[model samples]
Target chain A: MSHRARSPSTALRPTRRALLAGLGAGAASAFGLARLARADAPPPSGTAVLLCFFPGGWDQLLLLDPRDPSRFTASEAARTRIDPRYDELVGLGYRPELVRPRAAPAMVLGPLAERPGAAVQLTDFAGRMAVVRGVDMRSVSHEVATRYFLTTEFPRGSLAQGSSVSTTLTALARPARPVAHLSLGVESYNDRHPSRWSALRVTSADDLLATLCPAGAVDPVLADALDAYAREARADVYNRRGLVDRLQGARAVARGLDRDDVSRPFRALVDDGPENDALRARFGISRGDFDGPRARAAMAALALTSGLSQVVIASVAPAMDTHFVGNAGHARLLGEGLDAFVALLDALRTTAHPEGGSHLDHTTVLAFSEFARTPLYNTYGGRDHHSAGSCLLLGRGVRGGVVAGATSDVGMVAVPWDLTRGGASPSGTVLTPAHVAATVAAAAGLDPTAFDAPPISQVLV
Target chain B: MGRAPRRLDAGQLRASLLHATGATWTGDRRVRTNNDPSGYALRPATDLVRHYASALGEPDYGATTEPDLDPGPGFLRRAQSAAQGACRDGLRRDREVPAGARRLLRAVSDGDTYARAPEAVRANIVALGRTFWIRNLSPDGPEVEALLGVFRAVTEREGALPADGWFAVCVALATDPQFLLY
Candidate 1:
């Protein structure tokens, strides 16, 4: 099934090009063809949503509402406790159906008491809020559903199997050096797609230079010979694919290294300038504290704020799929790690550009898991896989203090929305991941139809 | 009431011992030792030769006590001559067999042990003993039969002999510098 409608909101106009040229080619190219590009083009204001996926199904009942009596059961009552953050939420007139961070920038979603499967929130970012219910994924396996969530195709067709929303968006809007697309840590298999435009992969920044110039250690004679060989090889590859433009662009980028605007951000970070140090402090990290995952995040954030990448896809190790143990063990493990991750994101939001500007208002953060856990406690004392789950969208574009989906007790099942009216219901309406991907594409100014899915209207401003 | 022993050429004895064991000789004139023997953690030939030489009460052929021979292609030929001389002298002396040697043979005979020593060690020791028997004990006699007494005594104490003992002759041949390098 594909989306048939073109975006009526996006008009292709020629006058727009003349205005863009007057502004700057770099801004125009970076923002894609939709937006009006100005020299001081406000650095392509958009949302930076992170899909924090727990690949295996996460138990929604536990996460959305730990104290739901019908779901938690009498035997499990002792295990359930009201989240301390609930009162802070209630103080804001938001329902205490689920636990939230005590010091979050915004609490836009809460437990839907009537809805069994779905939960959503509205943040303080803008009027934009979303509560996606009843997402029906085709595959039950962890790998399949993960691909489906990011790309929107179930039993993911080979082409879409490893593709993520970030990769697709980056390809559509090819940003420059730092703001293209950066995958931190062990990137998902989906980030490897060749069709993407942005240079999305990096194990380390040091590795990038090494790959470009490997003969740095050799004798002058040997180095010269190797350089010639490399040039020949590169030329042959470029000639075969007729990618002279790309090759030339790469060469130009290499030459532009000495330019102040292009080199500023990289120099600031690698050299541990004051701006970089402040950013690290905000994140509660130091240079020595950089692990594989955190280092990637730091580098990506640096790149993004510096305009080196338009999109950054960063991930931590998988933690959500708790099969054997239930509440006390597995859930706590996930919860604590998530707590740290949220803190890191908060810190990143506070990080300023080297020129003393904040990334918070401009960045849109979207965090979610592959799917939510089962509705009821199973024989293993843990939740099995469930199709319905929750996601958090927080940024300047989000509306705060709103709970989007309804929650209720329906024998054993909890649905996202009302199936009868296609509105809010206890059982949520079937919201697929393709819908989420579509929304992200739209926000980036691309026609969501190009991705064959309609943007979730609830989340769009 | 003893018969006069027959004598055999060192080269023939060395070739016989090598044929008895199955190992390719890499020409190198390095004496095998526990420290730097074959440049690997486990060298079957080096270990075997050491075990056999020690059992026969022969001079530590694996020691660097001897000056380095030019280790040219003739190194193997020289080792064979030296092994023959030592073997003949050892048999004539009838030196008291050590308890460890008897235990090793007993273990091999009883099927309880396979000599797990280095290949070079076992090969050198066995070669020296066999050469002695051929030159001083019996020239035309079966070498295996001649060594059977010592082998039985060692195996009986230790159980089955280690399978590595079978490579004794091959280790001797590989002692040449030409065989060890390249």
Candidate 2:
């Protein structure tokens, strides 16, 4: 019998299109079109970078290898067995020219020695880098930690924990831009962090139209009836609730509706554009597969280049929380997704901005998450969440081919760094999520201290 | 045509579960299994739930399996039946809660917590009760909530409620999204 013969009907039929359509107009309206409305130019040192978040805790040990077997614990022996090519990735710089091959050749950073099935490697990347370990977050709960990481505020009784570092930075850096903060996929957390940053969400091709188009006058009769209803509703709520900010934001969104140039949908934006074919081929995406993360990233990158927004956050789908399967699943999803993400960056780096400049030198890409996985494998062969995780910072200004922190043999030990005032390792000084946020803020030219946290001096230029 | 079951290759299954539950495997290890050494079995969802809950320090909120409630034969059918039964029970719980409590529950249960909940809780419950639904449903699967985009919604909504009854709801939702979804 054929494979489809054994599967349930629902399994064979695609469920994504219906899923996208079912999403509410409000949700769909979040992503706007790519337009270049010249506003006050960004600061002289303006930088635009992509921040990709892996929602679950990632296994840093697997991605950044430790070289010495003596450093390995009994549990981390499996990691020592990683393909030496990844260890080589430690020293490999960006190879923008390579096309057919998915990733650049791995550059081994340190010496390697084998013990049993495991092999240990070494690197100088960790030395110049700063890894502040053992930072105690107020809540071990995933939701709380997530909120803490993004907003630098402890999860409180209310859901709106605080504005995220990105939103805050964008707000402070470029207050004049319409879509200062743009989210390409699903918004993270429950708090209106995206909304707070005046972030416009664009998850699909359709959303692109709803957000950017100028509102055409509706049928006079229907418009009159709807206007009357809206007037009453607005008076009832706005007058009583004192929600001026919401009303203002709503008005701004409304102004974009039906606007001629802005209304042109993403399809038109990409249909014959220079990057269109390249995007489709590179991401392995087709018109039919337009809602997935790869498609979302491509769309968002196109928007960035078009100057529709200053900051864009894209959420890739197919969760990366690999519990039962160890290296292979993560290698394929996280590793490959990351590889594709880098590929997108490379594409962006090469693509000139609509205004006749390259976005590569101006954009900085930071991939991060809430935490890291434990050193040991479970009975089911999975890893658990640990507080200290690794983040990949890649851009023109960012120091490349450098491992910013240290991990011990079993991957449990976080080596110390005393460079920053509070930058310490798991064994020594404690670092807080706020510190990382501060680093990002400083890089964006926002005041880190505004959020009551100092920027991680070492990671910044 | 019947497609081959996406059999969890030992490595893939390990990776999927780890990413799904945020659990890690460490310590002196040998790949021991009840089945053959090379051939590993995918643990039942219930077993996976239990392991995950324990790791997350959550209460064991598994489905109540009475001999009387057995629907028999197919696992998916049985699970569906259990879910319906759970929803009915959740409705009973919802009825006893106060409107204020329900409102608070709704705030906490918004988004992922609300989606993963039994239909009864999503419909009938409010603030704290909605939060309870999340806790009862997916205590070990917080990341699932994140993936669903509900985690942030609940957080954003939390601010609209009063403080006295709010923190408990937040904690409940945090633990709930994890426990209920898996």
Considering every candidate listed, which one attains the maximal TM-score? 2
Candidate 1 off by > 4 Å: A1-51, A54-57, A62-72, A75-97, A100-131, A156-162, A186-199, A203-281, A284-289, A292-296, A351-357, A401-408, A411-422, A425-429, B1-182
lDDT of 1 by residue, B1-182 (tens): 13321112233333443433222122212232446422213233332222222111232232112221111111222233333233222322222355234312321222223243333333333544443222232323343232332233223332223222222222222221112211
Q: Which ten residues in a row have the lowest lDDT in candidate 2 chain B?
A: B64-73
Judged by DockQ cut-offs, is candidate 2 incorrect, acceptable, medium or high? incorrect
Candidate 2 lDDT over residue span B1-182, tens digit each? 13311112223323433332222222121222546532223333233222222112222222111111100111111121222223222333434576444323342333234335444333332333323332233422433233223222322342222221122222223222122222
Which candidate leads in lDDT?
2
| Residue A212 in model 1: lDDT | 22
TM-score of each: 0.48, 0.52
Each model's lDDT comes to 0.39, 0.41
